[model samples]
Target: MDNAPNRTLLDLQALEDILQQGAVRTLFQPIYDISKQSILGFEALSRGISGTSLEFPERLFCIASEQGKLSELELLCREKAIARFVEQDLPGKLFINVSPNTLLDPSHPKGETLHLVEKYGLSANRVVIEVTEQDKVDDGFLLLKTIEHYRQLGFSIAIDDLGAGYSGLKQWSELRPDFVKVDRYFIDYCDQSIVKKEFLKSIIELAKVTKTSVIAEGIERLEELTLLEKLGIVHAQGFLLAKPARQPPRALEASQVTQLNLRSQSNHNEMSMSVGCLAQIEDAIGQSTRCKDAHKRFEQNKSLMSLAVINAKQQPVGLLHRDQLTEVFAAPYGHALYAKKSVVELMDKQPLVVDENAKLDVVSQQITEQEFDIRRHIIVTRDLKYLGLAPLRDILKHITEEKIRHAQHANPLTMLPGNVAINEAIEQRLRRQNTFSLAYVDLNHFKQFNDLYGYASGDSVIKLLADVTVQVCDQSSCFVGHIGGDDFMVVFDGDDAERLCHQIINQFELQSKAFFTSEHVEAGGYWATNREGQKQFVPLLTLSIGLVRPDLESCNNSHQVAALATDAKKEAKRYRNSYLFVCNRRKPAAPIVRIKTTVHECSV
Candidate 1:
């Protein structure tokens, strides 16, 4: 207690020394662009000197504000950040956090940031001025004017800690910053909180309306990051991606990149049948090509309906329809009149250009909304560069074929994929030599339940099982298929197969009670006549899940996998209650006999 005052004096002196000597340590945290799977930029964070009272940024900034050196401290920090950023040759823009009060401070030096960046030979365009929203703005107009000044100087503006401050939405609307960082509170456990997920959705929708990019910060878990990606949030910043460091990672770790790609591929497989499948590599003509030359090429290729017109950057700019050109040539003295004119003069500039990865159904809807002619061709692009052309007929044909195939392969009762699709899924994984676990699920005593309770009640129980399985399996990378009757199959891509199996069994056990009567519930089962016409007490409906991790090196086809799963299911059915049988033998024995298995009984 006697040395408290002296310690305070020493801390104040340290703050003063830091401000004067500019001893701030600048660290950078990477902001990831999910779509590009690369670092979008780095947010420059300032830390106090090591082994000091203000080692963390929060205390350091608070002390600076209390000592009336906020503006000076911020300027010095920005200078250090800019110098270090340039020294390290970091990629993408540098995001520097500046408090609104600091920008509004009368003592704040105008054009000092621009001068510092210029001094370091860095472009102001590559620097993002993050307007920290923690400080209350008494004068909104002044802050807006200051932000506009930064914008005029070619500095992109961003609102930091949105939803954690007052007047955040107002600042977003008034200043219209180029980016907005969502507060970490909302990102925490977003996967488990519906309110947080909805809030994020609203923010993303509003950002789309304002044309501002949203960056989710403080993502400390992969689940949170995965949910953000699913919500179409393009940019994310968090420790899960890369923590702040003097030398931050310029690119995502290879494993993280693979996960991102796999998630993207899995999502595409689940949601979208990409239009790229229907795109044909058609020849494209340059914008400067003569109309006569285009006509000759069209005539040379008799089947060509239209030619995509591209710019020097290989981006689709327009389309030249054969019918339109033919009509012009058939006109009186039209060919002679327009012989030397460039195709750009007559090309349709508003032709629909769709990304190669666009969903087939979405593309179909776009075609319908545009009222495109059936013979018209649409330009397809990959990353904004022209890749091929997709005819309207081909898109429609593919959609029709897909609908038919889906109907044929989908089970009529639950609409889940049937055996054929399940076999194909297993075979595809086997061909890729990917290690995955296959869970074969069946209902024990299902036949007795169907007889005791009517077939209608039985169908309801089957659907209930399907719903529970799908709900649990949808949380991870797994494929759920209805293998006729009460039997189901699941192919999980990761090692969490046993956990997922338990979840499915637990959920089904809880939900299946609803299908039983009061007496049946009390007794845990009902009396039923066996197939031999003998009375017996039937146990309650329970699940038997057989989980097997197939060895890709030895598992040859889906048939062998099916045999293993079937044997494992037999082992699980030995228990009368909900149970899981994990097969220890990865490879099946000769003649596909029963293999060694471990039984895990699930408590109701």
Candidate 2:
């Protein structure tokens, strides 16, 4: 017992040594609620300060508990944690790590812990004690009693890292904790790994049934964060939210919240077919015919009153304002002469024009960085083909709305832009006829595999597919989108088409091996399978792609090019088992693509 450094001093001596000499100090790591996209809390991690570097408090706590000094160690960590959380004025929850053995002690010093909470002006409610799922914890009766005791005292309880190697599914049955934290190992590659995503997603479903709050830890990228949000995760603590510091973080800003809203609202509105190019955005601006409403809108807003007028063709031709019109009337150049002169003489043809397809952030950055003319409203277009004017105030308001909605409404898997983004992308591609590739990807026998392993495992598989697709395509030239579930589409060009598809599938299979049972991985490192009784080897995950490039010789307009690409993509789907090519060239319609052998013979 005396051999454990933590228990060497015994009782009062150990407590005094920990406080006066400061044997333990707590460092915080930010934990985010994946659904909310806001910093929900910080996980208080304990570290033993040696002469120089800090030691893992887990080792220290484990050794102490083994030596019968868990009570002493837990008390020391709790005291310091409360002091720091209070001093920092952290607005969100303070999550402190606890050894399960410590909490299982019926005679643990709850009285001292209560006194410390009162001393620091913190409610027992705001603190969540996180016990690691990495350890073997089977003390059901004691855990229950301890939880009941904490519940009465207003303290929340959480089971940390519940889907990792040493997970305890039985804790949910026994302890009924208020929160369940999905571990980082499950979340780290969630954006791309279907197996890991399903695994974590099942945990989320379980949390929902238990009515427990779920938070995903270790989010580092926008795609990973988006996937978690879509999977219905609510509380996240991660580096993207902010690194833990000595002070509390400011709540997510209004602008941030607005961005979230715009994304969410867009998703729901985007799925149905849009009438024409930029029709949705045009509807969003609430303008029917251009000039009728402009007269009324200009009258209502007196400050910076001006309107740009154009014919039905949207050719910029006139500028009008109450002030400008009044000046023209009073001038020696009478109303007849002023009105007779073309309005184009006054209107700035060189007006600052913004591409309508750009994100809100891009527009905001442009406004901030560029020198401006007197116009407060900037003309925007889809790919610089004029759509409408974005008033400065409207842009600010829209940005603010975007943050609020996007923070709470992001998707958790297949972070390739969601349904709303899918619509915008398709519209853009169809309008431009830029000869990009639209390759639809779906997993083979994924559902059966998921059913066999359970939903958590299924989600992991889905996330893996998304990750592979994103990695395989070039972010600069290719546009990848998730049309919900495991179905995904990648837009690319002719140059590296087949090679890129094969590369993505190959990488996905390689990454997915670890998640599969050894029996699933056949000899020669091949993860072979039976697809409808056929001996199919997904050693390089089987991906079906349809490629369409503009047939410059056959098509006169961009619309025909888009239709050709669409038709080619459909043909590609018919021969969907492997890497296949379908080009929209000028040749007479040939025999349809069938097996990989037939398609390969023609394309090669």
Q: What is the C-alpha RMSD of each candidate to the true structure, in Å?
A: 11.7, 21.2
Q: What stretches of model 1 exceed 4 Å from their correct place?
A: 1-22, 29-42, 51-95, 101-129, 136-157, 163-166, 176-415, 418-421, 451-459, 474-476, 531-533, 588-604
lDDT of 2 at 375: 45
Report the Cα lDDT for candidate 1. Answer: 0.85
For this target, which candidate reaches the highest TM-score against the unseen true structure?
A: 1
| Candidate 2 worst ten-residue window by lDDT | 262-271
lDDT of 2 by residue, 207-283 (tens): 76776778778776667777877787767767766665545354655455444321222222122222122222322
lDDT value, residue 297 of candidate 1: 95
lDDT of 1 at 221: 87
Q: Which stretches of candidate 2 lie over 4 Å from their true place?
A: 1-20, 34-37, 50-54, 165-167, 252-604
lDDT of each: 0.85, 0.59
Question: How well does each candidate superpose onto the true structure, as a TM-score?
Answer: 0.59, 0.41
